[model samples]
Target: MSNTLRISLIAVASAAVLAACGGSDDRNDGYTPPPAQPPVLNVTKVDGRYHHNKSQQDSGFRAMSDMPPSASPAAEIALPALDAQAQTKAQGDSLGGPILIALPQTVAQAQTAEQLASLLHWRQDAQGQQVAALRVQAADALGIRLGLLVQALPDAALLRFYPDSKTAQGYETTGAEINAVLRLNAQAGEQGQAARTWWSPDLGGDAITLEIVLPASAAAEALQLALPSISRRFVDTDSDAALQAPPAQRAGLSKERIPSAGSCNLDMSCYSNGSAERDAVARMSFVRDGKGYFCTGTLLNDAIQSDIPYFITAHHCISSQTVAGSLQTDWFFRTASCGSPYLDARRTTRTRGARLLYTSNVGQGFDATLLALNDAAPPGTYLAGWDARLNNSIQKVLSLHHPNGALGKISGGETQNYANCDGRHCRAATDGRGRYYEVRWGDGTTEGGSSGSALFTQSGHVIGTLHGGTASCSAPDEPDFYGRLDLAFESGLKNFLAAAQRPF
Candidate 1:
């Protein structure tokens, strides 16, 4: 039994790493965002998207499947938590209404398996005989995907949960807490927007909840229409909903200013003050450590098939991540030199960025994203001036990042070693998981706020994106890892520019 309930945070649509070997904590593929408390997987099968928007403390590794009935996790087969809370807030005859739940993970498992599983589990009941076990075959059973649950709820009806809500004054319910904050009087559009997700964990199992929710509007009564169609009834509108779709986009791409070091402006890389609510409890601060924050990208807006245009970023930076039923969100980029997000608007000038576009649909798991927008490259920004190469790692590349929580950390030469690999999907890893390049940078390594930093070569070329660094600068490990920039974007990015550049 889980000692406590942990709501799943954000999840990404595609996994960064593919576990090709026997799955375990050691060799199984995973990514550690930043250090915080180790994540506790109280339950195994919850569902929610992981948000790549903010700096985070990632949930460790675990293996999963791709199916629907399995879409949302039940509280039954969950890992016990490191902490504890009372279970079964309400049970038995008292079970009914839009349940407020925090699921372990969410996966859409078809009902066939559910029916078979239910039949197999059927046995003697209270009277020593098995009566018809029909809840497993109920009305709301047909629509078992995680999104269906959130979609079923009216936008006016809010659902929100805090993964950090573990203390006494913290939580009201488990999973994504749906408090019905701002009731939007939503109407079904001409065509209800439809979406499907193939998610990867940022935290652990996904999470879901609907306890104190608002009601639905008459126009969008799809959940009501489909609830009756469910034949396999084990699923319920009354019981707790497990890992549902992530509630927020979470990670996003934006721009910041790079200040020259050793000048009147304290010597650092780039800087920004943005929201950390998605990564931690509130806001966080970070700075550069090794060669420090360094990077460059063509902040662009170009024509696609004659009409669209966009600005692009590595997919790992903007893609949504999934977890027990939540999405960790990162809306802006920052460095340690900066304090909490948004000190003063004048201190940091926001860049022209929006609606990220990516190439996940073409084949599968390509790490590329485009920020579809209405404007061309802003002043001081360059759009695609180099060769977007592919599949070849080399030595001696230029590094750029926002350090000390400020800007101008790039322009420093740093040689990095090819550490471990996540899989064919994500190319690089570090012994420090953030310190692969530390073998070079003496004290100028990346700090807390340098994630999403870019690295280039001396000849002025793009190479990789900064992710992690040693636990600290003085640490023994050579902690620095980067996302290689090559492949797919060469073409996919061009297409996005054609589609995204438009009149707002």
Candidate 2:
């Protein structure tokens, strides 16, 4: 837990720096320190931001929310249409589209060693003259050769290319870049055939869009190699017509009208015990304030635990001064669970469940909180909303909550994306998912009655807390309101999980 992290450094002068980046599994790979040179040139270490050096470490950035900027795209290339590729490449497993790799067209026969040696800056001559030699320093760096290509430029001559960088192919620059490198190599090959060397520094342009001709042979094999690296997620680009709304609709919620944050609908739901029979509700007694019973404990599963007991209930329902009739020790969680019978006459007559972790934002705060189970919950019972991989991206979820005077009663609403708050307040958009658009309250909207209610996504992702609403739910013009649980509870959440794994 106390391990250190190193910094990262990038050399603007070389594309080779990228080799080390994607080159190895080692987190420490990718960067090479410059030889100690001048006092002025010495690399001084800075905090948090990527230093691109192995020495500085990852601890800072690993936990940070922001990332550094990347390099700019290469220059665009222009060319005359060439012949159709020898044949369309045989399609292999696709990485959506980004992982495709192949060679560019080849205009002529192979280049002679004499021509290659003359054109490339293979080595420097002792007499101060430049001598031609193979410029490649490493074989792995050459990458898998895809097929070839040849294209006629509006201004320049034709050329060939090679592709790499698919997870299957295992080259660099995953997708678009894969296409780029191959085309460049193919062009270099074409020049080699002509007995010329030293590719046009710009290769006509810094980049090329190879939607056209390509070489044959190795292209398909190389494309197969890049399968895994290709991203499968697909988001269609908007149609051009959608770009221009009818003049009248232009003023409506047009794409231009939508902010990156967009909009949402909200609904709110409140639950409370209604039965007048005091003892009847006590059977499921979780907490009893003068008004009524808030909740009764439910058993939970032992999975994902670090030797601790577990169970979940509303934060306030556990023990809220506003809700608990009395500040009695018996009111708080004593064991994993208990019934209104008060565990029989014998002080120890009650069955002891696992330790239960509990979560809650201040009553004035929200429906968000955490519970550390003293021990795992009883069999068959598990936390309803949880996904470690999905720390905060829950798309659609709903929660089950118990309100005062209600034992098994439940209240919940669809969760919305977390809002950015300047201070204690957080805002979000919503659609009529649940009760998010319900609930009348000035205590910022979600009334104390609705406090500690669980708000989840439709997909069961644990999004945020339903603390309160403004305009309709929390405030008008202001989106729905909820406890920024993820952010608010972020500080020690992971630490708690880690500690559970390694105990004293």
Tell me how many residue pairs clash in candidate 1: 153
User: What is the lDDT of every predicted structure here?
Assistant: 0.26, 0.23
lDDT of 1 by residue, 284-326 (tens): 1101000011122223323322223233333333332211112
* Estimated TM-score for each candidate: 0.34, 0.27
lDDT of 2 at 115: 32
Error of 1 at 289 (Å): 32
Tell me the tens digit of each residue's lDDT in model 2 across 1-504. Answer: 111111111111100111000001111111111233222211111111111122321111110113211112212212223223421231122111111112222212222333322333222224332222111111211121111221211111112221211111011112332233333324323223211111111001112211111122222112211100100111112322122233442223123111011012211112121111111111122212111222233222222333332223334343222112111111111111122311112111011111222243332333333433222222222233322332343232333332221122222223334333221233232332221112112112222223334433333323344343332222322233444434423322233332324321
Per-residue lDDT value at 361 in model 1: 20
Candidate 2 local lDDT, residue 141: 17
Question: Who wins the TM-score comparison?
Answer: 1
Task: Please give the lDDT score at residue 91 for candidate 2.
Answer: 16
Candidate No. with top lDDT:
1
